[model samples]
Target chain A: MHRIERYYDSIFTKQSPEQLARDIMKKADSSAKKRSFRPLAVVAAAAVVLVGGVTAAAATGLLNINELFGGRISTQDEQFAGELVGAAQDFQWTTSDDDYVINLKGVTGSERDMLLLYEIARADGRPVTEYMTNIPEDGELDCAENLGFDLNAGAFKAGNYRYHYSINDDGNIDVYNLAVTDGDISGQQFYAEVINLYPKQLLSDFEAKHDIFDWAGGADTPAGFYRWGDNEAFDAGQPCDVALNDERIIGLELEWTIEFTYSPSDTAKLSKVITDEKSVVSLNYEKSYGGVWTYPLLRITDSYFSSVSGRIDLVREGYMRGQTFDTCNDIYLLLENGDKISCTAFTGVSSYDRHEKMSSFSVEIQYSEELNGPITAVDISKVEAISINGEVFSLI
Target chain B: MQGDEFTQYVRKYSDMVYRVAYSCTHSAPDSEDIMQDVLLKLYICEKKFHDDEHVKAWLIRVAVNRSRDVLRSVNKKRTEELQEGLSVSDEEPSSDLHTAMAGLSRDHRLVIYLFYYEGYSVKEISKILRITESNVKTRLKRAREKLRAFLNDE
Candidate 1:
């Protein structure tokens, strides 16, 4: 192994935990000062300030300003609805006393936008709590949180927009109070859900039906975990979270691979005599998976392919021109003993479903013995910088 | 809950929080900024920690989300980092492992850091990330494989 001790030392020297922590605390203190001056008389009744000092109160892992600005605190008692904005313009919402009616339209393709709605209500007229979108199993079931409001974590597929709505316990439905912001919006919504886990029950049932599971109970000391869900799981048309172990967490795509094969041909090499017995062969391999992915958003990049000319290129070219000229598939070059050998490569194919719902995914192609040989090694070039839903998360 | 407990917790988990911030933003200053933000946030959240799990999850999520925000502030920031020959010290690898990690995607780097550096299980990571457990495992495997490929390359 090539040890880069100097490199590691330099990197560590650049950062110190104590200094970083102190800096964070100082920023929070400043933000807290700004928050303190904001008059809370209007919403004070609806909300409560649990902590007073930013620096003095060290027990709460929450910064002083967090309570002031962490979540979208809706303290309004009156019901008001705003126009659906951004990518959710396609959905139509109507409010009823018991439920908020939502019908989506104008979806031309399979892609959709993320929707996060809070069902706000007062308990005995004192704001008991705002239950996160914890909808019951049946679509019509009433969410028994404060105000009978059904909080929804919505991801609408088959569209270019997002939608939001709310129903107060007084039977007044408001669907337009939804706010939209770009960049990791879905993550923020998920963060809200994490803060309130009561809605896990509602999501748990949804995932139970629409979610796909890996092999369960595989070992006494398990190396992994598993879950299952069905259709409504992907209904939002965007990626949403699901409770895997009776805990509500966002579903994600688990990747698996299978071998694919293709036959080789000598159609391109006209110089080679058409021998009756010595037939040229071409082989192709495809790699893919079988499972529903958890992420609500999925994207694919331009595929790249390369092969050795002298060793494997001859075989690959013969097969390509003669049988199937699919340059889209990976074919590579191999060099050995001054002979050019042909090889193939296809990697880094990723699936980003907004909601981790797909059950199975794989690749298929033709196969041949002429393409098989004792491999001395392998070579692959990686490409990074692919974006996932505005967050440059990773394609690997 | 006492001064001693608070101090102990801070000392023990400060590195974890810093690493989380570093992985998310891939910048030393930003990571430091995130750590500071998280500590203060924790200080005020007053939502009592049920156990270490709850606190860990809260810190990691806040650091990650804050770092994500930092990424958004300057579009030119990431663009400049990716451009050739900037030699930004933050981007330098601490070890061959770190270099390989720097070369990875943000998600890959995050998963690797949390799993290997912080020593969290896929389940714990899933909770901390609000992602599925299997997703964490798959990412870990792919990250390891990629790291192998990177390290083995001459």
Candidate 2:
């Protein structure tokens, strides 16, 4: 095989056809039923709405911030808000550039997660009428108005945005929920800038030409990672750990370093190694899944294995394309005396990298009877199948 | 397609759709979700396919579009790495290639997977991805150069 072809083969594992058939059929049946039911449901809903005086509310002059938020806060924000004892709620900070004046209304939530409430206004003191006009009559902001947080650290993340027009007839006031999961942001003060302010016309035009929410190769914005200096407004503040309901913003210029403390430890070490022309098999044992149990790990380099075994252990299950299968049930340990002992409590840990055509697995097994003699090779002919290039080979 | 033909269609093209989705999303759950959505779309689509190639092309297009939708959603921030659940492979190239692919941008990886692994010509890929043929060729070339640089650096 060519070098690149082999690498590609190793990475893309063909899925099991039978399992996929079953899943597809199930979904198809459900969708067919839903398709049939939709028309009747629409008729029923129309009759009810006509009798109940349920008219859609019309848009008002100034957008209500509380109404826009809908009182929905993420779990992280709730937890952060619960942790702070005395979070400030009355500080205000403002900064302005040539194009816009940015105001920091308040900071709330905990060290783990924070909510920054701020307003952006045109420097010419014009009501952000242009931006508000583009908002749908239902007060829904299109995908273009969704300003994602970009970090300079190159880590990808996601956040929630909620906003409405300022009550005082100013510009837009929005709440940005900034969350840090794999790092610490406790008691840290940093500068935040509003980077890209899209004009109403361009946003409306872009939203019209494409599916605004459809991400497929069209929306190229990095979801959670922040790019430094992308937003150029120089506004610095110390976010307090308080309830998300707190609206007090604190103004400060503080330098803080974001430190990451999340790390992954290697849980397994090579116990036995096998070298062959086409493959390398390594036996390993590691503590995983909360360190309560130790799993036998195997690294099989080369062709995928339907089943693999060492002198002492046997793998009874296999995994491919993120699906697990009990490929083998009954396993026996062949001793030097030509007798066999049944194995029980078999657990397999199968890992495969399709790009390199390598599979690693560790099986934890318990024998029914204690052995008194030396053992030979493990019998794996009972495995259901092994697949390579969409071809399945039965071990039996 | 209906019933038996639809079953055959899924059996024939599900893997291709899945690979394309995985190449873009890199998350197993996300890929599976995309695969399911694409297959469901195919099952319900009234469009008739002239041949296996046409069906395959349509599936790839849907998979790519659905995968992009998942990536662009507000919840696309993935806290866990793809390899976190499984043990690291022993083969150097296997792990190295995974890291290298991860280093490349999603756009670069998608073109490379389509051109090399899926065996699609530049023209076919351009149609499947809704881009110009020159764009596809350029992405493929740039992807190869980036892959070479990554491998050499490693």
Candidate 3:
């Protein structure tokens, strides 16, 4: 044995093989026997106790909200949120009464989280250069809570708009990127009501000094909300802006509709299952045309809809070398009983095929559930590949 | 597998499974737990194996996957248990080579252990780990460089 192997072997040699095997066999034997009703009753009683304990803890405030929410609350700025900037859909809308020019620059994000980039400016070719000089220099503006402005009170009222922003270096608020961490917006049109606008300098200074903006408090300022009466008139790609106060500034009342499509390469639907001496291999082809790339999936299932072990060939060579590769293709299995189960591939070895002049790869697909029957066929008929050149290839 | 056949297979490959699991986990009890799970999977798997080499490959793949799952599980109690159950001693490694191997990252250490210690080829390790052959080669090269740097410093 090699020296390192010997050292590893010695470290783990404390567990006797015979005893370990005996213990495993015992576990297997006990699991094989029919489960008794008494154990089920005990488990039900235990579950009842657990629920009661959780409810009591919640009522007593002993359960931390951060812990309850899976501990996702972070004091750091959201990274990778800016990557969506490049892929945002463009829109330009101006208010009817005020003529404030609001350009919805782009929209980029996943199904659950989205980022909206927009610019608010003047309509008569002048800079919106006024800063809120009333508040204390040390004070910070809470953007989300200041969505609704109270005109009589001369300040922003409290509201729930879970969004954040970053100022550009030019000190002009060129892009107001609103990070939305809620429901799917793909293929849907939505309107952003421009209730108020704070000076770019004030927002930037507050952000710079504080470094962390609380999404839960109102900004105490003299900047009142502009009640644009024609919120219904705005639509995506329409040129419109709103006039707040006596200023001829155009602020974007943003409206946009997004459509996400996938078109893989020409050979997306081509798939085959080949069984060799060692194991079975499934070959699948997938590609994504544009937008946020979802992983190209390949699933293996038995006749009974139970998943099997398999892998796909989709590893790009430059991924490990700091190269960004798009993985937006969908593959699934259609069982005999008319049920569909999503398939995923394990990370596999990737190499370049000199003869084929392309990166060659294969992944191992692992399914834990045992199958009731043998797999009948390899299904690539459901694969969708959207090509970068605007071609949709789907297997019928 | 059943009765004598299963027992014989366990006896033949138990050390191999244990070592591979330990290399990934760095915890003895967790490695043992992974070994038991891998062996149980082999017992229940209905797929036919062509030979001993095939069986070994399958066991390594299953063990590696199970070890990763254990590491990724959300239960904090398990992590506490692992800390209490495993600890390295100065006497564990007799030579600088063994000590250098322990200092590598889990990914680098695993590839090295499989390549140099367990005598697996880069191609075989790729399939077993579900990575590309080029990735395996890169990892191996990096692991050797790390080892050389450590030994030279010593």
Candidate 4:
């Protein structure tokens, strides 16, 4: 055995992991039981949950955004009421439709998080799903969930989360959040444009549950949501909503351009900070071969923050060795109320090139799994500080 | 994923998971406890895998996560647990490198084990740990430095 392998073996061979594995599996079989359900029924149950609650939602064909946003917070059910409601910032903007209207109720945030309020429903929504038969077939599910909308600002593309919706007569609300990461977002005019939607989540779940992925042909659709039997040429095995921009679906053609100027709240405050740190920026080693590690200086000419978003403007001092990569530093908004929010989700192109000195580009601080979803970061009194790359700039 | 197929995967992947857990916790008992939970999770995990590689990947990831949890929960008793659980065999390497590695943190040991012992690149390790590649590289370098520091102290 290789000496290193021997060393590792000596450390662990005292316990026979392979034997243990067999033993555990035997034990697992003795203790566990198997359960199965029809795939179509499971899909129905999931749809009911996606639309809203099961028991109450089946009675009404429309969605329950209020309940879905946090939970049914009736005073009678005081449990959910205490934790969530106060933190969301309320707004009233509804796109009108005959069957359903998409409305924005509010966005909840933390310093660097734009967490969507709830879990991503797929083939998982339960009891209420069986009752609510209005479950959208294909593209409807995409529209029902948050489809990515492009947010355009002056030169930089702003960051956005999924815009989720449910259509109903009781003013059902659909919502999405933009991370306040674009530091210079104050007074920047932006118009959110709804575009093609992809049912990647649903497709994956279906594949996992029923193994019905490739059966639904999606070659014709540009935006990836399947249309019902768009690919008769390929195989009519399953239905897909691939024709997302098909004019027939009115929900898909939300052509109204609602232009809005984003001005920070009156209580909004700003902080200024700068950094010129010289550090080993990147390492490029792939064990089969020797690799290069670069020592680059991150020169920030100016980095600023409003209460909502945080931005750090960079001025590069040229790499000493290898990389000229993009550095999307995380922008955090620390609220007065002990909550920390990471609002910087930049959709713009942010890369630092040695040839192009001090270029202002944007890259997403790619929300790690840690910052998974839309967070409750709203309704805080004031932001005490904004942290960027380990440096805290006070905003209070 | 059921029947003989499930058994085959559990037997193969569980051993990999236990090795990963052992590297992270350096405590056989803790590693065993973590292995049990992760094994049951494997037995019950519904996510279908494309291949044995996928199953191995999932198991190792779960093992790493579970080991971290054990490290955190047993932080206070860690020193006692490590000494008690790991009996130094007479054949154990007395090299300065080994000594330094022995004193290193669970995170450092984990990164080192994945890189040197398992032949996984920093990039692959980053994906498994859900951290940036730079972070994985940084951990490796820091582990080396801290290990050398231990050798110097000796």
Candidate 5:
């Protein structure tokens, strides 16, 4: 037998077809699980913070930041994250309320933004997938339709986007939160807390009730994490530390509050920050949704392109329901030697229900071997036109 | 179908369905999920087949389509580990060829697996994968070249 075939044969032989068949039959035979609604606050909360330094990579196999930051950041962009590895001073404490454990993996930043990396897992070690059954792809589920947090770093406010996660081999769900802010928060002692996990409908209500977005620096009205829709008075849209009553959130239950300090001076020392608003270009496409065509404008508001990865901020008009493409999808970089490079992977972030009005997203693009093309770590200096779904926007 | 018939059908082609799914996804968990889903569809599906080979081809097509759906739903690569729950032999062969095979792209890997391992011809593979016969041969040629390059580098 050929060596390649033999190698796979060994691996494939270990699988038990009978066992898999039995598992399948079991799920088929079993009835759908009964849905439960247990309002929060009265769930017998047991929350604690186990402060384990960023030696998580030393303890765990890998940080898995690439997995979380996939398609959004470039390989060159990863160098910035790598610089902060094992350099976290006072980071990564675990927060366990009742059912799940949230471990703050590390805190990373540039002069413009900061990222609080953390993972969530069941306290009892059951696969979180069993409960968060709606999404089984890569063990990912946005348990809360909308997530909000408060990182008490001066002049830096973090708004929670859709929770992007995947279960690791150890059965932990790593969640990524990148908060953009102004000014340098160097040597900042941040009491970073992932304060709320709820839906967007609750978000508008919380904002209406509170009327203000974040607690002004040192205000002491709502202390910490709270259950949304519980006290109606509890800040569902912002960070607070008290759970009243009412069970709105269903899975990965509870708000995570962990205290960690960050100093990005070391990591940011060599980090390159590039911006090009000098070149302005927009592409117009007759976007078809549900057999109806609407002309949507794709405008590049701002951009930062590295040789290997970059982020593009886009403002799009002409909204449609269930738009299935990212701003950076199918982009290619025309190289110096007349070669083309593919924008291999991307993680585009945008509001779920941005209809009619303008919607904007700054998507990160990187290359993975997933594409069947002339893929390379993008050399940004080449003679260039940015290709978006076939229309070329010249960068020369 | 009776309970035993369901079990019998699934067990007979469980590995093949899983292998097809795994080639597209490169994710064991997603592959396992796809396997169960495809088998369940078969159990409930009203279509009749000429024979076991016909049933096998249909299952392969479903597995491929389902894997494509999973990929298109999200443009993200997943964890590359072999599923931790699977029971394996202590004497399983360990080689650089295993590593090189994994390094190939999904299309390349799928075509290579079918052509050389499963003994599917270029024509049969094109039909199974819903691609042109030329596309199958191209992928096979590219996969072989890539594997050779990878091994040579070592």
Candidate 6:
């Protein structure tokens, strides 16, 4: 159906029977020659063969060492044995000790072979950094054939080919290597809490979306999003106060605090201070849109409300944008110390006679340098006023 | 079975084995080499042909794998096989089909060859290739889609 398939099929179908027969004959001859040839090393090392054969001699362990070594060696079987033996490095093993542990496993029967390991380190392995194929897990050790193993999935498809190995120097200290057969599998795929994990081999073409850090593991998690605000919010038509506490030396481990205040019964007061390094920094905000409302009898569509009330409504668009807005006139601040700070009007207050109310407004910000980022706090202050049936009124 | 019986097995399955080898190698010479090599391996393995199907499938798998190994070893030689007898020019007389096929990835090419040349259904290809049936079906569909794009683009 597809040209690629059609073309491949055509060429494949055209392979001549005569050509195949000739090639088969040639291969048969080469295999026969290879079978007949014996190296001089095998001839010179009789004892090596005797010793080497013992390890695998008894299928379920029947042969005595002395008998196995003393028995008459069949020339053909010895030759076959020589061909089957792999290099010494193939059987090498490493150990890992301490609070951290690494174990290795080898799989056989793959187009490409591998050694894999699952490595774990102490929970407090500070600023923990782990390498996937350290020491024995990499290079020659990663080869499947060397480890006398095969992979069930061809190397290209099976997410990754991995092996396990550990190293222990007899001290309290230890390191683990998930002996990766190739750079096929990235450690992060299987190992949790790995410092950083990005898929490398096997379907590497599937690119991951960036920008959002994986905050919580879910579709609605705070990943795939960017942070904004200068980083502060404003009440639509007003100037936003921004201040950065650049005095302290900012390091990845640094912590700070933020605070904000505003006015006219329409206010938002919030503050935050970082408690631990690597701890998540969360900012809580509360904004109330305080204003006057009027009902117009001439506009039938505007008659949803028979009368107007002066209220400061806190509009929250929920977690993500485009959701229905929830209005709240009251906001309660939850602090790290478990103390709740309630926002109260400092001066200007407004009221409406089922029609007009309100007065002056302004916003303020307070911040604790104990947290990261600038403008930790925002406060809004506004003048209160009202309109009633083509009449303007002010309340305080 | 006797040597004669083994030889008969080789003769009957040689073409099928070579086709699979060629699918992996994209070369007549390498495919032929794998066909004979697989047969020789079967002979020494003392593996009896329970039925024609078993023997045929074994020969194909071994031939394909052996050819792949050979192809992997010869870097320069392998590229030559990929390029050989598969190109077409605007003015020259050549099969654009081969040209397009030479451009498909190994998985796509394998599925295509098994489906069309070997006359294997997706299920059979899955079993022979040691892959999931779904994977075989997907690969076949993708290979066809790629070929269709290559053909239309011309």
Residue ranges of candidate 1 with Cα displaced over 4 Å: A1-396, B1-5, B75-95
Q: What share of the true interface contacts does candidate 1 keep?
A: 0.16
Q: For residues A100-134, could you state the per-residue lDDT of candidate 1 as single tens digits?
A: 32233221221123243333233233221222222
State each candidate's clash count. 90, 19, 37, 34, 8, 63
lDDT by residue (tens digit), candidate 6, A154-219: 111123323332222221112222223233232111111111111121001111111224323221
Residue A186 in model 3: lDDT: 29
Global lDDT of model 5: 0.47
Docking class of 1: incorrect
Residue-wise lDDT of candidate 3 within A112-150, one digit each (tens)?
444455554446544322221122111112221122211
Give per-residue CA lDDT, model 4, range A247-282, as digits (tens): 112112221111111112231111101111111101
Consecutive 10-residue window with the lowest summed lDDT within model 4 chain A: A284-293
Over A261-354, each residue of candidate 5 has an lDDT whose tens digit, in order, gives 2112333212211111110000111111111111233566777788567777666543322222342145766666876666643445443233
By lDDT rank, best first, the candidates go 5, 3, 4, 2, 1, 6
DockQ of each: 0.23, 0.10, 0.12, 0.13, 0.14, 0.07
Return the clash pairs for model 5, or none: A39-A247, A40-A247, A72-A364, A224-A240, A224-A241, A225-A240, A225-A241, A307-A378
**DockQ-sorted candidate list, best first:** 1, 5, 4, 3, 2, 6
Model 3 lDDT, full chain set: 0.42
Model 4: docking quality category = incorrect
Better of 4 and 5 by TM-score: 4
Give fnat for candidates 1, 2 and onward, in order: 0.16, 0.20, 0.24, 0.21, 0.24, 0.11
Off by over 4 Å in 6: A1-396, B1-3, B76-78, B81-94
TM-score of 5: 0.33
What is the TM-score of each predicted model, taking all chains together? 0.40, 0.37, 0.36, 0.40, 0.33, 0.36
Ten-residue stretch with the least lDDT total in model 6 chain A: A246-255
lDDT of each: 0.36, 0.41, 0.42, 0.41, 0.47, 0.34
lDDT of 2 by residue, B1-154 (tens): 5678877877777767777777777666677778878888787676657888877877886777677667656466343344323322234336667677766655677888888777888788866664445456546655776788888998
- TM-score of model 4's chain A: 0.21
